[model samples]
Target chain A: MKRRAFLLSAGGAAAGMVLLPQLARAEAGRIDWYTGSDQNILDFWTNIVQPKFEAANPGITLNLVDAGDNAGLQAIGDRAVAAMASSADPQADIFESFDPRLPKGAIEAGLYVNIKEAGLSNYSKINPLAFDGDYSVPYRGSQVLLAYDTTKLDPANAPKTFADLIAWIKANPGQFIYNRPDKGGSGGNFVRRAIYEVNGNDTSKFTVDNYSAEAADAALKPAWDLLMDLAPSLFDGGAYTAGNTPSLQLLSQSAVTMIPAWSDQALQAISTGVLPETTGLVQLSDLGLPGGFSRSVILANGVNKDAALKLADFLLTEEIQSAVLTELGGFPGVAWDYVSPELRDKYKDVIPTTIPVFPGGDWEKAINDGWYRNVAPNVVRE
Target chain B: MIIWPILSAIGRTLWLPGADGVSRFSLETYVFFFSDQYSINNLMVTLWTTGVCALLLLPICLPIALYLRFAKGRLAAYVQGLAIFPMFVPSIILSYAIIRVLGPNGTVDLLFNSVGLPKIRSPYLTPWGPVIGLVWDNIPLTVLILLSGLGAVSDQSVEAARDVGARRWAVLWHIILPRITNSILVAISFTVLGIFSAFTLPYVLGPAAPEMMGPFMQRTFRDLNDPTNAITQAVISFAFCIVFGLFYVRSVAKNRKT
Candidate 1:
């Protein structure tokens, strides 16, 4: 009799505590987001972005998938193109950190949503400089900066101009190295800036659509000469690091005093204690180093385009943008005014207010190849 | 099935899309690879690393295998264990350990400094870096193949040579060395093949430019973002590997006849 009373009271309590059962909503809206990496990128989405978006719109389910690596991401682009041509389901709704230039002219073909007119509530707050085109919705960004060891060189003495950098490199042989231009963005941007330096500060010729073999040859020859002149001063007597990480690794080991590194990665390494506390970062005053924004594109013909759009909008919202800045050491895609005041105050000194972007596409590829052929011609041992 | 990928890779190298968007036969990739000094440098580096590694493996592993074959004690077992130890360690881990030990201002340099020795010129990011790493990696397999070949020599053959006034050195040279010729061939064949196509150790330890074929192909694909060029590099690497592969096949066929 006592057990029955206890069971009845517990059942009553459970009944009282439970909310009304909602209708089954597996089919309501399952938006599959294909992010390229299963590392920090996936973690950012699954942990920070998903919970709030789903909580706000209960019926919309956020599905995370790892497309993984460049090849995998390219395949996803191809799939969208194929599905668009056949008028079938695109299968994927969202792609995070997707290269918009993939599939050649997918942007012009309307394969991706036009975010400017998509009516994202935070559209007004978007950083115009960071935004690529209507196809790309950049929510987070990072810049390449001159990362140097403070213990070895004082901030006052660190190079401020491209000319100073060259002079400093010459003065300190075997203390500076950049990765090979083709290997990583940090290295690529370093070469890009050097190209800018030698071409009489003409950033205009280097554009998203502006590239010609004749023009490149004329402009790049001087850059190559300048870089080749500086090569003998680099770490390991002109040896370049393989990538962004290796450059940093050499710095961490104190093998090199300076390198070009991504702001986010450098910050992350410093905070995570992978790099020493004495490692310092500074941007060049003249023709500042280029930075990039991570963009997410929604397929125009996605099965759950509306939900995907909503999620894209949510990524630009103040809370999420702040999270990107705090959590990933990434710059907010939204403008400084749109970011929380406390964060603005915290990062104003370290974060460049106007992050300059280098031209990508054909120009980047040409520069990388030309760099290999011209500048580092003597990389082979005798 | 294996041949299909190789054929496709070769096909990709020869067949390319023109600026006119018409598919046609082309030798542009090959022309570029052979004529371009940078590409040729990369090829030469690959060849150098393979040749050096294959050459080094015989000298490094033969002595340990010869000792293990005749010695009857726990010390031989320990020597065998030490020689084969690298086979268990992953290449990536080995590369890092090598970097730590041989990199600039690393353990060796620090120890040398403490003892008032001149600084060691680190080989961490030079052509010789991959050579050191590859030679260490191939030791186990080379020794094992050598030991098996030494097994055929028969102690009586060695003892008979010794009885005929042959010293230990003479017995080793005349009896042991002659008997293991096939094994040495087989070991060299395997070593050449493995070193020819190796990627990880070379990619990590080797220099940025003049990279090995494995890293060269990958850098062309992923970094240069030229899949076609990468495939061309692969086809060329395959051509070199095939030459070494033929030696293995011929030796095996010869052994079968015997």
Candidate 2:
């Protein structure tokens, strides 16, 4: 009886070894795209990008999974980082929206593919925004700009410089407000732009790696003085909005003449009649406000690495970029010169010649915290 | 589970790495918190909000709780439901709803404007914003707690007070108030702690500067990416909540002992 049981166990173990590889092979042909986008963008992928890409490249199934929220995407990113460290199967081929930094050394460890070096057809067209590194390829860009109601304020009279913007706020008391810097990016960039304006408009002076207490004092104090001087003219006499959307709501309600808001959100709001037809958006020509981009990254170790590359390349194609604009009301990753003439013409007025970029890490934290500490509530450094 | 997270958080606050490799326990976080003017402002705002919310919650909730506890029939049921309505709604939705109903050019403004009145100043982004929203939010739970405490009061106790020719106010003051002391303590303790720990309501409705500790900790942790200071801010908030929590622990223990 013992000999028979041992033989049976050995047979079962042999079968398990044979079935595991078969199960692994069955998943080999499929590529999974993980995203942290909301339902609408996920719908764009499920209903639009999936079918189109699948039809273009037959036999390779594209599995687009909505990873819920940003933290969800970050979880997958951490998992990929772990897998890369351990040289294990990542189980994910493409991360549609992902964090570029994780597990302390994901980017330096090269856990993600460098799409530009990957030699995709649309490699040159991708926006040059390696927020961490070339760990992710950007597919859409959004700039923070001044959103003003044309009925209340003339489009031609929009603030063109940081000085002009600050003057306008004081000149028109209780007619302008941005969100708290810590609350929203529109206000954050607005604060960042102001910091640049005061410190000789030289953004080159600040870097993610080189922030020091001395540098913060020299660069930030002037910005605080400027903001503190301009505080009384804010909405409700030194009131700021809660967030980007609330700033827009203030504009729509005609409570404020102008507000800082994302280009995509303002355009969508105006198109949807949430903001009136008279609302206009303009970027600062003098050292333009910093912007952000939604990007995709590929797992370095995946069975379907080649298929994932194809999808990443496909996402950057002008066709998908236009779809991103039309369907999601987002700025295309491809430059205006690369897009169709009609698409270019429609969005030409709002496009920045070059999107001003700011390094995050320590500098961003200091500016945000400083805005809270020194700018808004009237705290001053001795 | 609860103790582990709390202990871990408390440990994170105490972790101070020296210039060398060795780790040591220090009050560096506490010192930074106390010395930093912004952090002190946040602590003051948190304390202010707690005090105002606790004080205001009683006046608003006590009358309704009294009505719900003493009154009868369909009106009492409707009043009870109406009192605790904010509990069912999520705080995010409540903040948005509060904005629409009470914000500038909102329903109140529009209604007033239709009658040709001037637009009123909104409390939407002011310090009062959180206080108003918090009071609205806390009503349901405060009422529920007070009602449970009121339930323990016997009808015969009130009748005995009445037999001694005690008026309504006298009976409520001498008989009802004394019996439900533990309940009021519990309610205030719970509300104060909850108010101190509240995030969504304050973030949505409160001022940008001098924000409560919840937003302060979040901005420090997330926006500032200063986990040490964020954890420090949290430790400060936890300390505040613990002060409020003691009242509850004491109340529960005293009742248990009895």
Candidate 3:
């Protein structure tokens, strides 16, 4: 009798071991999100969004992975692309990109799931431009603007046109600054706008999808000439800052009067006391500034497609969009008409015009290379 | 376990099928890395910065190590504490602190102006900025290594040299330095590797065009989305480290034999 009882107990224990993992898998489903955004965005998702999401849907978990910006996105992209090539799952179900162009290549490689077909409730509220071939969902936007200290520079005398800006830079030597183009997009935006201004203020000629070296040379010759003319008049005799933050730091310390900066970042810095209250931002009237949106793409082979779609849709909700404006100081991913009046009024003057998307990968490479080779050598003093 | 992943990554760069669907072993990545002007420029910059850092650190570290070894008092302890304190501070905070103190019209400039001298522009925006930060960050480790080497030297040996009518400088030149040659090489190897693979200091302080290999490789892999070229850059960096590592090994082996 004792031997028979021991054998039955041993068989039951073995069965329990075999069934445990299956039970756990049935009980809990998890969605992994990869992002290269800053701390504020990370906090909003972790501290605010995650708990609310989990509460609404039981037995589901959301994992937020903070990757480093720009460069971090690339690392995640490479890994994800590699995993997809081997018919395996990537590290995350959702991938967040700092630049839309960063994910354009991956999307073309068919790495992302098409969330448009998921019939998300909040999809209609987003700006049409935010959709990238039905694979991406933009969450926030950053617009490039001329940020200046009001205590030093008269707002009325601020440059309105590219020509006016160049003259102002020359007149106030060592007071105006822009970062190197290859370092940050604000500087690249400044350079691209200059190229637009030189081509008879017609952005159409340069807005095509393909890159033509001959066409670029002809269109950008005058822009290079303009940059060469402005070189000697830059801050510290043409030695520019390395990145966006340094430029803002220089402005705050009264080292420089003005710099090209992201509108949302400038405001956020001011709110955090990094920039003084007297700091003001303005978009050029004659020469439009560049603006782009940050987007999220769901991987094609994600483990929990339903959860990923739900989270993406949730990020586009009015409540989250408002939080993006107030908490993170980001432009809403949805149309401005959907935003509160107070927030809309605050950014009315600095609202960015829709500029052309970056032409393509080859054009981008050429632009960065051209700036380093032809422009940086002449402008950089030491 | 670590070696397994590194070898796999390298193998992927050398043999993995590319986007064009060709899977064969090739030196194409190396050819691409060497042929690119930007990559070549970054490599040169990395070497230059590392070489300068090693040269700058030796004189500075040697004296501090010697002083700590010879001096006996609370002042030596305080100095040692000060040297080690910077290591406790995070590199990012240290970098920001350095920038604030050395930026245009910053603390240094303010001091110069207050003293009635012409206000000098800060070099923090230039290549020299990163060099200074690198030295500041690595001085503690370099000093620690040299101090360990100094411990191996005996005061009796120095006294014997003095009794033999050797001068202070001669004693230091012959007895002290020869005993610590291995230590100096070790310190130099650390500085070289630290500066070559540095990201935060150079990213915050150095110019954008001629970046260090760490940041350059990151940008190539992440921003440019070219993993093969990035791995190629990594392989080159590894080659440099290996050369210095070999020197370290040889010095250690020689010391053991002696």
Candidate 4:
């Protein structure tokens, strides 16, 4: 009798261990969210947002999976493409789309659901520019700006135009640094702005869907000339740092006084003590820098389509947008008037009058290739 | 299962439809990769770094492995422990530690300044940086392999050589080195493979241009969005690796035959 009782108890315990999780899962449906943001954003979603969201909407759990950033974005896109190719459900219900062109491609491919039909309450309040057709909802935005150390530079003397910036770089040799164009978007933004300036501030020439090699060569000649001219004045005489973080590191260490950086990342770095508090940002008046919105897309064939739409709506709420601004230093997805007054006041000086989106795929590739081939060799010291 | 995916990748590389939506087998991708001088430069840089890494590591690891094999003391134990400790540390963390120690205003600069020496710029932005990091990160594995070979060496053979009036250097050159030829080949094979395919070290330490094959391929695939060219680059890297791998196989087979 004792042996039978022990065996029965052991079997019962094992059965409970296996079945309990399934029961809990059934009670609390899971929604997988894939993000390509940094650790702080991940923690905010897991530690703060997940618990509250779960509490308010019982029987639903938020599964946050950090995909990665930059390269991580590509990985998520590749997985989505593979799933779509096989006629299978994507791994995640909601995915953070970092590249603007990716969402456009996915939408065209019919891989994303039309969120406008989901009847999200906050969708109407979002900036219309943030919407890509009816498929994606913008989560955050960041602009590229010229960031400099106040200790090494005078704010009054900050360059207000592209010409002034180039002159400053020429005058202050080894005091400016920008990452390689292919490495990060910040350096690419600087190059694009120069291209815009060289075309007599005409933005329409390079924004087309089809790449014209002849037009590109004609427009990019002056920009390449400017870069080659500034080459001798760059940090280490001509060699650029590898990425955005390295350029910022050079700024913090006073090796270089100014660099083009994403406004949000630069501010976040300052607040987190990665950069000194004396750092300041300025938007050039004559030429606009490139910036874009980060959006969340719902997979058309995701397991939890309704839940993903609900979560995306929650991300656009005023309270959540406020947290995005304060906690992550990201611009709100809503209009400036919709954000809190204090947030506007805090970022007023650094904000540009216009934030242009990156050019379409064909033009972008042409510019990147052209810069590497025609300009990089002439500019790089080694 | 693994073969399926490998075959699928190869098929994609050979015959996958491109942006134009045309499916055909062609060497167009390979031609594109080689057409650019920059791409050719990247290939050369990758080979050069791999060669430099192996050349530097052989002298450094062999002496340490020999010492660890012959020495008997707490000092030898400590040396052994120190040599193996880096293997446990992640490559990312090790790269950062190296940057801090060797970067401008870092410990190395501070030491130089304290001695009234001129401040030296950090080498982290140059090719030397990745070469140094790769050599350091790979030393432990190389030493471990050499030590294993040293263990297989016969003490009696060395004693016999000494009894026959052979010098110490002669014994080492003829007996010890010959016995460990296969092990050295294995170590060289691993070193070449690791350095050729290294990403984080070169990405963080090396210059923006002339990137090693690993990071260059990643950029080409993802950033450039040219999967065809990326796969071709991978195929090239794989071909180089197979050459070394074949030598390794032959060495092992010969040792078995002997």
Candidate 5:
């Protein structure tokens, strides 16, 4: 009996040793990640993605650091951070910057790694025009849409066009509010959309391929004039202007009624009870598209290039994309037709089917010359 | 090595490229600042705000310092302690507290609302707030310096003035003013330098486009990452500060010689 007990104990010790390495692999080594996500994203990645990635790919741990926003992401470029994530286009890697003029810099600086070489260049999955020459990927796309508080103004009274919106502001003094273009992406997108509607000969004429100095100004003139005219009806009766977040704050506090907001921003606010549940989002009938789109890029020389590409690819997967669309307020980059039925039912109505017109490469140069000089001075700097 | 970088930045700031490798030195930045009219307006506002603070500080500080020197009571010690108390508080905490009082929705706004008036917008955000906060923080040192000067007044001089049939007003004017003129100059010099290098109070309180050297320097370094412009601005500010410092030192030396 004593010999049998000893043999059983020895057998158990050998079994423990056999299982230990496998268990350790399941918990993986840490892979540092940087993202310009709010606390919600921080929580989502930690609770959901981190554990799942760790479990599926043994010895792979994702340690995420919150960079908060674009400015914070830019700060990482100024630092020795492992990776960066932003909503701006590919000026830096694992981030976002919209300046189309910067693609050359990324290529020249070797700050970009072609995902095509990584066996993840599934370009056919995304909209043809949205695909870059192996530089950036559309992470989550949304357009600037008109949002209104139902309690203050009924749908019947809502403005349908930029012209209608301007007229309404005149009719009802001190009603419309938006942040300055420099302050927030959604706010800047809204202003730029106004420029597009007022300037472009047709929607297709607004593409990067078709951009010219004359087209920019001609499209921008009407919007510029309208904003200058409506400057009086804005906050402080045009005496002061709030930036994007503050403008949203004004909308939330019932200080203003009609404003432009991102689709996800509107949904995020409504879901969290930060905004009224009765809020409505609509695309302009005349413009067809919403406002703008965001892109994501990979750093060429990051600490974990392979892992970052894997994560980027995983994020683009139909399942993960669907989850992002349905669970998160973000719109999926994959075409609506390719979306799963579960995701389709959940987010089809909430996300706009219409693609927004983004400013081609000339957007930055035009803004620097036109709006900064002409528009900024008229409004109070606040 | 540091000097080379600073000089390079200054050279780049001053010289603009043309067709060839050679460039022309032009004060385009300074010209731009002046052309906007903000530079003069901001300077005037900064001075006026600092002036008001100095005026208010003068009477409150003088009496407390004098009492600390002449009086023998516990109250004198307490007064001296209280006069320099602002120096002990962290500058950020001090600035934040002022914001609470002067902000649009601050306590002062409540007072305005009670009278059916609009909320008071802060002068700080306009360029005045920082000057006011800076002077409040600076008054302690000013008082301490003045008090030390007053203490150095000899007992013999007072007796001599009394024996020579000098009236209180006459003695204060002729003897006290001349004797402490150097201290007064020192305080003024310190105040000028203090306001010149100031970043935080103005930063928290000033408007979007602050005209002072502080905000300009900050923007160049942080947002622009154009260290050349930042170094150039610093060098210019330093030049002006050095002139004032030299004048102050000369005045103090001249007074001692007399």
Candidate 6:
């Protein structure tokens, strides 16, 4: 597959020279893009957004590469592809905002052209939380949520807090399960929520500016102890864990009563009829849903700066955002009010009004602290 | 291409897990490697699998090699080809076949339970699954070596030993075995290194917790951004390769030294 792409790239580059003069006049040129979308989302991009963007720009090509799963994109980081279509900051003209973890130092080092200075069309419409007059803007905000089977769990008897959830699990053994947080993003987010509830949500101490090493450990102690106590009643005696896919599989099988689900998964389930349409959504009272502002970034060093900028402007447009958020499962980076009514209706109730941002200056510390690492495994042992 | 990558991987592996230095001057990775139980546990699993695989392969290969070596004509040629056939199938296919044959609901399990015998727990979840696969993989090479070496032993010498009033067991053990000693050493040394660096069999077939060093390397490089640890694992894996590589080289070179 890689070899085929290379051959096509070579062929396209040759064709590009012959088309360059014609492209400048009446203008049909290709704009290469890289995105971490699946086939369904890719179809939406190709069949829907690409045609619209190309029709508007006329004679412009939009070459997109699906960057694959989260881990694959993370492994390459933003720098490795900064020169390719996948690069956030290609060496030539384009810049994109797909990576939220764009290192502040790398951007400050002038690695990416600040989109704020680039004068994109309708920059004002972007949410301030996502577009901070900086190197990138957020395209979506996803959260981890708790869901229950409508048939087995009564809405009136639903657990409201971490303590309530645990007590319910104890009362009904083998009735609840969540994917392992270390293996799945939703599980990790759920674990973080548990830590916050136990620590009274004072995770600010773990930030670089105020990180007291002892305080971090102390905060996680109770959460760890609780997890150790709850391990046995977990699904498969806490031995078998599923990622989001398997967690959802278990839910669909009715093998589990409760599980931690990504907001998008729950929304997808409800939309597709895999989950009951009447399912209720709630945050733990003590710990609000763990949320993070998803940021997309442009590479400081990219190959085609002009084409990349054009692609970025195109993606940031309402047309693409509406089509993407509606078809793919997630909230858009634009404000809630700005979304099309059709898209809003599909997700408004499902998407949380508020999301927790990983407090600045190093979230890794907060995530890796003893509370999460030392105590999380006890979930299977009970 | 695979050989170059494996060799380059060996150089890359020399650097320990925690060492982040650009220049060559640190043993911090070694210290970190030894401090962790995960590393030690995986290494022990590799050794145990190697031992079990060697034990299972030796007896089966020896007699078959002996039959092919001394047996005359068409039968000998057919036996030689049939004996070497196991090496033709890739190790992964062999393992999958074993899983189907020995899995919980597989033929072996059904057979045992039908006879009122205790249900045989599968080795798939244990190091033994990989051990079995590796043993099956090495059988052909071991068989060929034993067969050819037995063929080279003079028929006249065996007949003379038997005629001198020596018992059948005594004549066979004393005269026949000594002639094939080099071939046995060569097979053992070569098979040891091959199994030591094996990754796929264990990765596809082994249990989760007590994973071999190979799977642990995959998780470190791709899942965890801890390249230092990945490099450390690659290094230890090469250390196994080198130790076994040197032994094989020495055994081969012993012929020149003689």
The most accurate candidate by TM-score is: 2
Pull out the clashing pairs in model 3.
none
Q: Enumerate the candidates' DockQ scores in order.
A: 0.32, 0.73, 0.37, 0.34, 0.06, 0.07
Better of 2 and 5 by TM-score: 2
Best by DockQ: 2
lDDT of 6 at B235: 78
Tens-digit per-residue lDDT, A12-89, candidate 2: 999999998546531776997788877877888988899989999999898777789888878877877787778777
TM-score of chain A of 1: 0.83
Question: What CA root-mean-square deviation does each model show from the true structure?
Answer: 8.7, 5.3, 6.9, 6.4, 11.3, 8.7
lDDT of 4: 0.81
Worst 10 residues of 3 chain B by lDDT: B119-128
- Report how far off residue A300 is in candidate 5 (Å): 10
What proportion of true contacts does candidate 2 retain? 0.78
Model 4 scores a TM of: 0.78
Docking class of 6: incorrect
Arranged by TM-score with the best first, the candidates are 2, 1, 4, 3, 5, 6
Please state the Cα-based DockQ of model 1 relative to the true two-chain complex. 0.32
Q: Sort all candidates by lDDT, best to worst.
A: 1, 2, 4, 3, 6, 5
Instruction: For model 3, report DockQ.
Output: 0.37
Fnat of all models, as shown:
0.35, 0.78, 0.32, 0.35, 0.00, 0.00
Whole-model Cα lDDT per candidate?
0.84, 0.83, 0.80, 0.81, 0.63, 0.65
Question: In model 2, how large is the Cα lDDT of residue A26?
Answer: 19
Order of quality (DockQ)? 2, 3, 4, 1, 6, 5
* Lowest summed lDDT window (length 10), candidate 5 chain B: B37-46
The alpha-carbon deviation from the true structure for residue A43 of candidate 2, after best TM-score superposition, in angstroms, is 3.6
lDDT of 5 by residue, A164-215 (tens): 8778778877666665464455666767766656665255556666667786
Question: Taking the tens digit of each residue's C-alpha lDDT, what string does model 3 give over B1-258?
Answer: 967867877887889686899888988888877897777888898898898888999998899999999999999999999887778988888777887888887888888889899877577657788898998899999999999999988999999999999998999999999999999999898778888899988888877657789988887776677788888889889889989988889998998898
Q: Which stretches of candidate 2 lie over 4 Å from their true place?
A: A1-29, A36-40, A66-92, A97-138, A295-306, A379-382, B1-15, B159-165, B256-258
